[model samples]
Target: MSADVNTGTREFILPDLGEGLTEAELISWKVEIGDEVHVDQMVVEVESAKSVVELPCPYAGQVVSLHANAGDTVSAGQALLTVAEAGVEMGAGDEGDGGTPASVSQSGSSTENSSGANLIGYGTSEPKTRSAKKRSFGGKHAAAPAVPTVIPDAPSQPPAETPASPSNSSTTANDRVSPVSSPLVRKLAKDHGISAKSLPGTGPGGVVTRADVMAAIESGAGAAAHVPAGTSPAKASSPAASSDQSDRDTRTPITGLRKVVSERLTKSRQEIPEATIWLDVDATELLATKKALEARTGEKYSLLSLVARFVVAGLKKYPIINSSIDTAAGEIVTHGDINLGLAAQTPRGLMVPVVHGAGELSLRQLRDSVSGTVGKAASGKFDPSELTGGTFTLNNYGVFGVDGSAPIINLPEVAMLGLGRIKDRPWVVDGELTVRKVMYLSFVFDHRACDGQEPSEFLTFVADCIENPISLLPEL
Candidate 1:
């Protein structure tokens, strides 16, 4: 099968969305085939490993075709779509010339085009410019006639075969490659001793989906009568074996922000040698100070804001804790400004939204910044840039009623401070036993960046501020 190739049609391949990421999942396409798109107009939305980003078209023309559908994972440098230059005539190709136009197969692979257009970080096609009259599409010019295009049909498949005799099928099913698109579906098939290749896939292009695998299992393909060797027949045939139908377990693929968080946490644990030290601090004075300030000025000040101020003051004294490890340079890199990361729990997950220059902000400013950033994170409106470049992390787990945790250090940052719930506890003050409001402060640091003494001193300094809020006045 061949397509009518248009010489003026330019193929736009997916460009590299930085941080060494190789691919992205198509979320949705904003423009359809035969639609006139302007330069810099958003064409599609894609979810990369980091975040969901909208891709803009670089050239102004009519969208000739879409290469992949929504939910399809496309690799960098792969053709995404084709756009025909406005006012350009379609010319027939030579009979001897054999090339497939930018077309996508039912199997989700594209036919390579030698004359494909390229973007930065991919191929080497130069950018082309049309005449000024055809440069921008507006009003009447935008209403181009919708040209009907024929999309190639998915490959044909043979008639479905019934389950073969156990002796012949078991080995054949296990050895054959499964035409599955998702890794999770393949895993499910393997766990049940079911061969995905033997089952007729109801998904596009005969690709096996999770639903198809489950259907095969329900149809007795994974019956205990044909259980493979070394497996318990009783366990396989039991009602519990089919309990997955009751929604006992659910598997969700880690993608988008969650995937990024997983990779970053794994890298931090593998690369950084960390140590945690915790101390209990009297927070009666700090709470009283906040109340007094709010009453006198008619302005509310959060405990987190006060704690953040104390952290900044402590960082000034022990600047080493505010530094990050530059492994590539073999040095500890310290910053002149403090970008404080406040860990907030959102509906999606935990995210650390950064306050760019916390050292320069007053208590009120700090309170506002924390509130605004947290609001944005909860609504999923915060930009990816706002989630990065944090020099030190301040996690207030106390809100969740937790007392303490040996929190992981947010890399490449050297340290993270955890604040536990403040509760009234029996304490000795001036040789008398009394109830005092106390909180646990857990400090974790990268041992490579600083020795035990510096972090200990930093934690102690913050603890002192909490105990005696008057001491923070001078620093403020």
Candidate 2:
């Protein structure tokens, strides 16, 4: 999609973000028109159906145009922006919003320092000699021509007038147009004297996330920022208004990530012949083991991590539980790597972040990896690649304080393991009645992949690990 502009310009088009992702919502522009951008420098941030990611540009030159505005949906191969290559003459229009410095002549090397990581597609690997040659359209690379912003598959609207300077605007939160989601995040920004609208959002569709607030707080981006002391993050309304709001049913259009989740879950339910089995396990030893390990090593350990370790062992002893039915190929695909998927709940929605080669990681390393991936759920920064390639999934419904659930299998994966909250309950221990910590384990599987026997064995093995933690030591 590269086009020649003048004798030295390249129209940068969006690249395929990830597997099956055809479109993404343009969140924001990192570089405004006339500003210089280098290869591997993040030029725009977009949220696809899979995840939110910052896109690095390949061209190192002055930005001449932004094809779409924030909140606009852009498809792959669509022109994102145009960049005027280095060593090119410029007119007054070549300058950015404020104005380009005389330093434009020296933009060759001064503007080419790239040390950022490239994402799924497009970036540092792109070349510098991709500029377009002259054409006969009665044009001389019209420097920064007044081109209409192109938005795909949406209603037409007049283009927004570009501001004179790129800086924070002095406006009230109510008056300022920004995507602030949670009231809690608003309060955080308000407490620090900063405006949530001013801080960059890292959440889905540019919605501000709690992690974004903490980052702002740590960076002192909130210091001396104004948020009215009396201003409530929640919108205030009269009693009559509140009553009217309650009367009308709210209908939210599911489009981005939510749309994807809906389609996949529906497919899982409609296509896969799934079955659920449950067992109540005594978790007294598992809890005690987690506590003992933490006390002895002076390092915090999560119960989920301990249970995940047990699940990995169970999968190894029973590999059939880790297989998927490839209906199209008429074969069962048994993945070699134990790419364990953790059902992560984020502000955006439910996401499964897979830990590649989870079986290879030690207990401590496993804990760290799980913790780090789940931690990113708050910030909504999970890369598209991290959300796929799973052979099995682990869902902790207990985190929501639920006892048990027959959750649907994450498709392409044959089975899913669910953990319930451990609570004090009466149980017979060694022929005597005693109070013990007990939790229900729900194992869901695709009947097409395995029958009752294999899944029963896997669940029983995991149950044994919970009942007697010592049994896992020999296997480890």
Candidate 3:
């Protein structure tokens, strides 16, 4: 490892390491410029949207320059550092157009084409400079770039002549940043077929206020802002765009956890023939059991744990329900032990953590495990093993105060069970209409592996267990 012999130059750029990561913060640089690095050596540690990931150097050479400093938010594909090949001379400072460009250019030069820097060799074009731009959750330095102005109460007007580029104007608005609008606003806009771009905002800095959109609908000018640019007066009078300028926003680049989840879900759906079964059970006793257990053990557990307990016990009775199909071996696996997964929603996406040997655990132990798993899932810190080896999955929609839904079957596992809210429903006990706490359960199964008769019977068995807790006491 001599100090001055690297000849080839290669650039290492930031990569989109996934889970909806738009940018990453450079945590540390492992290799310094002038330090020789081998391919696959740890080059840097960058914190992504979900986790801190170490990126490896792809080229073996001496680190010639660090393009990005620590603490900078780097966009995907932006150059992070450059490496010089062994024995290459550091080129002169003068910019020459004969060889391939240097990496410092604004658009950035790829390592494949960039010229090796040398004192006597052919000069290279200047590399692109790193963009000094940063994005903010709030609007970025809201000195509004001069662009066309649209008013909520009045007609759209041309922007006053100004010096800002059109590209900058398109993205500088604050409306593009707020991802969490109320559900009512979302539904209203969706029903009216109105897009954010078609609105003349009434909120701060011409941002679209929900009330502004509602008013536009009520006042009969709903079509005004939506008209196509430069249309005739009669056609322009209509608020709905004549050509329907909206297509599903499907052009987004697939990266991160979303990509992984999408791929797995697609594969599972395509490969597995799923069959769903529904059950409306009187959960009056199940709710009573939960209250009693919480009171006796002085431990806190949600309805999710209660449902998980039922699922684990049911899978024990119907072991086939907790199995994965072995296509290679041409066999169906019936799990003897249960690793029950409880579906938890996080900001990143839905994740399931398994309760190991769930049948072996007492009710209290099961509750505690589910509580910890869900807590870790919400904070996004569960280890990879905690999420794997699930014999069965449970999605509790009751937390959202919903009634019933057919949840998608988790991959590999034969079935997933959904738990709805416990509400009072009329049940005929001894031929009398009495109000009993009822829950709607939907079981989704892999039709290829699960027999149609077994899924319905399994659901009924789970309902029976839930209804009569004393029946489970004999097995326990």
Candidate 4:
């Protein structure tokens, strides 16, 4: 490794992309070797989580070599491509965001500066134009006026009143009452291209909620029709659109995170002989226990948290459920510590961030970890380690008002415990009929390594534990 050695190769390595992505699947190669590429031109599409992303080229030059092929698994810091920086008319800095486009405008909008002189480190690409024609309103329904960038304050004839800014303008797209907001709310708003000021928030300190963004989008669709009515026929002519459109639709390449998910899921289903066992439990006792625990601890507790704790406790009693079969060793490898994977549905896709060493955590600790990890995963900030190494999985489908579901086992994990909605149902108790809070539980296990008898015992243990949770902590 001599410093004086002429190393002319510029390596384009995979970036971590902030979500702590360690590995990404190559979806496709947009530019082949010998193709003249411009800085910030879209080079590839990688899926992370569920979002399909088009990665832009960071350098302007002829591609000298391709480091990886489509469908290949790539790790962060591994070279994806190589570009020769010689004889390129454009000049830019060398720093790359790993995923940020080479072209960046002053305002940070990626306007690709294909011209060599305009290239910085990477140049910004031109903004993709959304709509060129002005909005119009059709007959019988007058289009609402375009909300001006600034609204004029109403003139009031009052002797004394609250002091108002003389320069107070009307509400506009640029006007925001408060900018400090939760990242989820901001991300939701950005996804819809919505102006937050127009929304009335019901969250803490007037923070926007997920419902607010959804409502705003519903309102926009009606407003879109109204706005287009006022434009001229030539400008307002509707483009032919497919009628079979989903309410919200996006098409992304199967690359990066999505690609990995696709492959793993397929492999798991193909290779694993999985079997499911179902049990209906009377959750009334557990509900009461949860209430008592919450009151005693003076903390907010949900049934999901209680279930998580119960699952963790059950894993300890049924150690095989917490263990993975090491086929190479021809052994049933039982783990000493439990790492519980909590399946969370994110806007981009499904993510299971593990709660490390969950067997040792209390109910409160489990709740906090589950909540924080899911929140971060939804916001695309979960660390890569958070996503891997799960001995078992817990999937709560109750929030969707589901009674029970046979959830798929995450690959490498032997089982997935699905929890369903707790609802009042009539049941027999000591030869008497009674209405109780009932929840159906489904435990799906990989049957290749574990036997039917073992899984049945595991489910029975879990069901009994949930019904009699105090029995689990006698030694605690």
Candidate 5:
């Protein structure tokens, strides 16, 4: 929605957080009503698809109204807050002649500074590239874009009655690229196999919002979306029906991150013919090696980072598992940059934080990266971009006191390596029964990409590295 003019207040629409992200859940408000706020002041914290981002307000004014409450899922371009500032007018800079917000411009200059925090897409727009660009996560999966200088924070759901769009931003179906700046809208379109270009957008400047895609999906556009077996498509819940059900049971509406995880896992299960294999390994040597390294260097290294070293080497030796399937292209895409992801349970939910280029990092650098990213994940403060572009994932269910698990593979990626709890278990050492520090490695792979042998070799290599840490030196 574009900025609305009241006598003195100016609306601050949710600025685009680049990587195709369309909506975010409001976590908390940093400022209260009537509080004085400066330009670039952190106004609120929002949780995008995978990260918690603090949105900075661009206008310096007295805080007026918060359109949505905490935990509200705000769509991109929706009105978030209104500011009443002196000398602030509904100028051309605030919106285009057609009344659409300027945030839709996908420029290369993103974030406050080029060397600032790991933010989303570029911000500065060139006159030639001022056209509304299709928003996408950099890879198969992406985070939200940055808030541009012209636009500040945005969003709450629009009113039940749809607002009329400006006449210039018409939705005529010609040979035009649909102005889809929201990743959520694109995702909904792709999930239903509905090409957005076929439908007319109701958003400002003809940008496709999630609602338009949903309407097209409901209208039976293109291929029918796959509904989970034994489950029918969900319908809009009636208030009366929901009220009656609430008396009998506590039914929480599934939305936001939980909804995303559910959909992603369902897709993974439906599309992937994944097979799991597990083996117990003697990790006594690996423990000793970690302790020895710490004692000599007087530096701390986590088991995860140390194990990551082995996983990195194993991936190099067998790169087939470090890949994703391009369903549209019918191609198996192997990644040159090994972005390592770790699956962990955070307060928000199960999130896989990614380290962009894990393959090139040394053991110490890997430890630092893993530690920093994992810590941020635990606290639920990691940047959204850090959650995308992962080639492989490592799950340490061991910390949960579990021996083994057949975990679901993160989508796009073909494989996931699971580490079980290590304990003193009796093992055969040199043909003799002896107590050793043992752990289980559970490997899951998409059978579509490779047969059982490739993953078996990769798993065996990882297990060997754990059983004999020194054996990894050759690969080093």
Candidate 6:
């Protein structure tokens, strides 16, 4: 049904989610057509490359229409929905039939009117303008002609159809804009050498989807057919192509967080010249200290929290490890505040949640921060901010029963400290061999950021602290 015809309608465009993200997959819409929505109320949920986020409505009004459906990928600055503010007069051109104003263009093009809607942390708004002459794929439902004014109590009659001509068809093809919701779908069509504008979309409002592009490929409308007749088709059957898919019974498309992780790790390896150093430390004292503390205070003190304290202390002495290399500027960037990122594994994938101002926190505070952040990450409730801005990373791969690993350096950060499993090992104490708790500490650092001297000393200092837990008492 139509909203109040007298009310002015404002289109809400999708705001840019941070970290240089250009688009997001629309997970679901919280509001429906004709539903009333309040300012700052969550109206939609979207899955970005990093995480899932709920977007709040910026204007208070009755929802006139939803521009994209669930599972559609939408770009930044695209119209998300229309809200007709209460008690505003609608212009003659803005009126719609059956009480619902046409919030979106029937041609499936983005709206052109600029609405200066602003959301906090996301910058200013811009209009997504469409061309004057609308184009469409061949469909049973044609676009309705624009009505300039409505006469009072006029009889509702269908507009007369105009006969199509050969010239009109040619012009339509030349001017045709694909009814695609996402840039990804368009890219798929282009990659397969298929014209999206020529394909009839089965999606709502006739929007082309990725599945449609795949269907075209399966129907022999792929890039191979578009090749010149004289060119050999050897490229398609090359050894490289077969090797790329060799022995893989099942293949999963890498998207979302996994894709982001792959890109970041790839960049890290390509850019950072890294080195790893490992040392086995006598952890008998550290384990005893934790047990003593727990018994004295009747509180649980995790070994990870204790080790994190040692890492913070070590960072204070070796600040260069907390720095990042800006290769483009040919400079080393050092951070004043230490944001400790703890790597935690969840069902979604590996995630590093950062604890801001970690160096300033006490042992108990660090424990609480680590516990809380890890809990949120495991439950998939952590914010994107928590996943970034890490000055250094603390990895406890020991939980997985590993002895040592050459951990890759987290990008923008120069180093990562890994703690391996603490187990009983024979140790020589006063010339007698005895069983003692031992653990391996693997320290990976960017050689460009600092020489071996600093990282070596840092690892030794941490090892000494673990061997003699009482040494940390002065700092505590």
Tell me, by lDDT, which candidate is best: 2
lDDT of 3 at 380: 62
Q: Each candidate's TM vs. the true structure?
A: 0.71, 0.68, 0.55, 0.54, 0.67, 0.73
Q: Who wins the TM-score comparison? A: 6
- What is the Å distance of residue 443 in model 6 from its true position? 0.8
Q: Tell me the whole-model lDDT of each prediction, alpha carbons only.
A: 0.70, 0.72, 0.63, 0.61, 0.70, 0.72
lDDT value for candidate 1? 0.70
- Candidate 4 residue 378 Cα shift, in angstroms, is 3.0
Q: Model 3, 343-391: lDDT tens per residue?
A: 8887656777788889899877887888888777666656546767888
Q: Give candidate 3's TM-score.
A: 0.55
lDDT of 1 by residue, 1-476 (tens): 11122345555667877777777878899998668987667899887765677887766667765655676566676556666666644334311111113322323222223323334553333433322121001111221112111112223744233433456543433343334444556667776657665565544334456688888767666644357678786656664555455346666667666777798899999999999999999999999999998999998788988899999999988899999999998999988889999987765577888999999998789889987886776555456678778999999999899999999888899999999999999999999999999999999999998889999999998999999989877876
Summarize candidate 2's per-residue lDDT along 1-476 as a digit string, tens digits: 45443335566677877687777777889998768888778899988888888888877888876665665566777667777778765665433311212222322332322446544455543345323231111122322212211222234854346532325444333343345544445765665556776666554334456677778766655433443468564543443453354347343446568888999999999999999999999999999998999999999999999999999999888998888888889889887779899998887788999998998999999999988987898976787789888899999989889899999999988999999999999999889999999999999999988999999999999999999989988888
User: Which 10 successive residues of model 6 have the least lDDT summed?
Assistant: 132-141
TM-score order of candidates, top first: 6, 1, 2, 5, 3, 4
lDDT tens per residue, model 4, 1-476 = 00000223344556555544555656688988667777667777655553445666666566665544454455555556656554532224221211111322233221223444332223334333222121111111122122212232334644223323447634453333432133344555555445554566543223355566667666653222323335764554232231123244754445555666788788888877888889999888888888897889898777777778778877887788887766667676778989999888776567788899898887778899877876676565465577778899999888889998878778777899999898999999999999988999999998766788878987887788788777767624
Say which prediction, candidate 2 or candidate 4, comes out ahead on lDDT.
2
Which residues of candidate 3, in runs, are more than 4 Å off? Answer: 1-252
lDDT of 6: 0.72
Residue 169: error of model 3 in Å? 32
TM-score of 6: 0.73
Q: List the residue pairs that clash in candidate 6.
A: 2-99, 2-100, 6-90
